[model samples]
Target: MSLLNSLKWKAELQAITDTVDEYDRPKEVRTKVRDIYFVEIGITAEEKYLSQQAKTNVVRRIKCRWDNTISEKTNGLLIDGVEFNITRIYVLPEVREMELSLAYVD
Candidate 1:
């Protein structure tokens, strides 16, 4: 990757890093925890395998530490420690938390 792209990823990674407390601070401090890949349908071989679980049209998957904000009522945050699979996403007002599945972009 170019320096600019590398720097961009690092910057975004730090933003996500700030959300955690000192006690749970990540062991590694770089872009290792914040890397994302995109899996598209047809365009790439990745979609064929991922869409196997579904009977409908092909979809996409990406490895991302999805942005999540916790609600005071729901405890604060959920889905930490990286590795986010975004099959389908929804916002639950009750808990004010974002629920995610385990699927990453190929």
Candidate 2:
């Protein structure tokens, strides 16, 4: 199947905004940026070992169409009623795609 067709999983990109409540307490509000489709990529054993050694929590990788709004500041992704924190983002300019590394939110 084509890459675009393989992207069957739908996800919501979320960003955390810091705001002050009426009582003056700082609060984090999660807002959805946009919806996207992606295909999950398998994690290689070597990559897993390296991430473990580096103390990174990345457990999953997904590839989607390029989106300029997705940056390091993006908090997490909501997919299938589950939340996953975005650990890293890799941009492929040649293909206009982006790969995101994710870790389960505790």
Candidate 3:
């Protein structure tokens, strides 16, 4: 994965957290529960044409896509269409796990 991809993923994760936080309850989710994928935000190279120098210019923008996928299986709870896997379920202090899912993109 490239740096851009990593940063984009982090942003997307934060977005998910924000969305979940707005829920009425701790809506348990699942990952890849349905025929869905993730969204990757970016400016398509073909969207714009620029000179060599212009192409080298860096721009800050936010974009997203729903095409990323995790073709793996593990012990987790499926909610709606998201996956809340037991990434790290502890017993002492608290349970630590992560919910994953393919972005539901139409």
Top TM-score hit = 2
Name the lDDT of candidate 2.
0.83
lDDT by residue (1-106, candidate 2, tens digit) is: 5777888999998997789999999987778878989999978787778777867777899999988878756478888888887777889998888999887776
> Model 1, which residues run further than 4 Å from truth?
1-52, 55-84
Best by lDDT: 2
Model 1: per-residue Cα lDDT over 1-106, one tens digit each? 3322322221112222324457886442223333332222222455555456563233432222334632212221112354333444434445333333233323
Task: Return the TM-score for candidate 3, rounded to 2 decimals.
Answer: 0.17
Q: Write the per-residue lDDT of candidate 3 for residues 1-68, one digit (tens) a residue.
A: 43334432322121112124475665434333332222233433543233123433222222223223
Per-residue error (Å), model 2, residue 49: 3.1
The predicted structure with the larger lDDT, 1 or 3, is 1
Query: How much lDDT does candidate 1 score?
Result: 0.33
Off by over 4 Å in 2: 21-25
Scanning candidate 3 in windows of ten residues, the lowest lDDT window is 10-19
Task: Report RMSD (Å) for each prediction in the order shown.
Answer: 15.9, 2.2, 16.7
Q: How do all models score by TM-score?
A: 0.25, 0.81, 0.17
